[model samples]
Target: MSFDVICLIAEWAPAVGACRESRGADFYWDAPENPNGEDLPFAIERARRGFDFIEAGFYYEILRRRLPSRVRGKADSFFGSVYHELGPGCPEPPDDLADDVGIELAKHEMYYSMRPTTVRSVLEHARAVPWPEIEHAATSAVMPPRITRHDVRDIEHFRSIVWFHQDWLDEAARTGRGLIVLISQ
Candidate 1:
């Protein structure tokens, strides 16, 4: 199974609250009945500042997940923060988030983990590490002992992931907002 990461910016406190209340898997399901489904309240889609989903950011989640927890925590702070759960009070998503049970089983249950981190904290780690250093680490990061390596160390994939987060971080720093990362497999 492949993984897709959805990076969303909580432009305001209300947005952050919405992220806390939302089901991470909800973004993928937007049937005709659920007209407003694709509109994840926490995510500031193209409506505002031409900001929408960062398609490249999905790889960042995949890269982070491949690394061992030991390497993630200290070696890579920024991406590690994205991998692990953070923030003040994050609510647990409902078990049956999707109306369609089959969809829930195939998607949600397979891998639907969401977490939020304040923009300030994200910037702190991001700012501390130089871009070149981050790139170096990502390319050389070791996978978990049990994980069979594949394209986890691909350079192009690393570049895309970095570009995605760099853009998001720039926006968060400029506007002073929080971020919510949802991983779906």
Candidate 2:
């Protein structure tokens, strides 16, 4: 499965824990129940085991996976992110992009980001990206993006992904704690 990413807090703080609105997650089952019927902790453990199966940061690997050779790099997948926490320590993209099982595992892994500092940096970079201006200009073909040449669909998708991380980072940063990344396929 291809990888989907999320940014989150490193520590589960008391305030965060106390939030009745949400557990800082985009969507999912609650603490006592993970996406699976099992408890969160057990689901997380199982996710970790599944996470250990893939590889990351290899463009050629992506190319090989495509029937028409569509290769998306780590940055491209993260919406032109500068976050480096996702490559080595983070698990690789899954083989089946449609594999919900693998995505669940990745979600658990990224939910508790392993590299909070790096993720923060990535969030900062994403926020700094000129998405708004470029989007407006592109609508008129006035000034195209200079930072990347990804197709319109990829660019748009990446922009949304970056926005998601920006929000997540902002939320976690408020608590003065590091972040965790949740990635699913």
Whole-model lDDT values for every prediction: 0.43, 0.37
Backbone clash total, candidate 2: 14
TM-score against truth, every candidate:
0.46, 0.35
List where candidate 2 sits over 4 angstroms from the true fold: 1-8, 12-116, 136-158
Candidate 1: residue 101 lDDT (0-100): 28
Q: What's each prediction's clash count?
A: 0, 14
* Deviation of model 1 at 145, angstroms: 15
lDDT of 1 by residue, 76-134 (tens): 56554433232223222222223222233334322222223345555576566455544
TM-score leader: 1
lDDT of 2 by residue, 1-185 (tens): 34444333434342133222353343333445447553332112222211222222222123223312122232333333423334322333221111211233334434334234544565564455444444543344322243333322333543444444566557656645544445566
Error of 1 at 147 (Å): 12
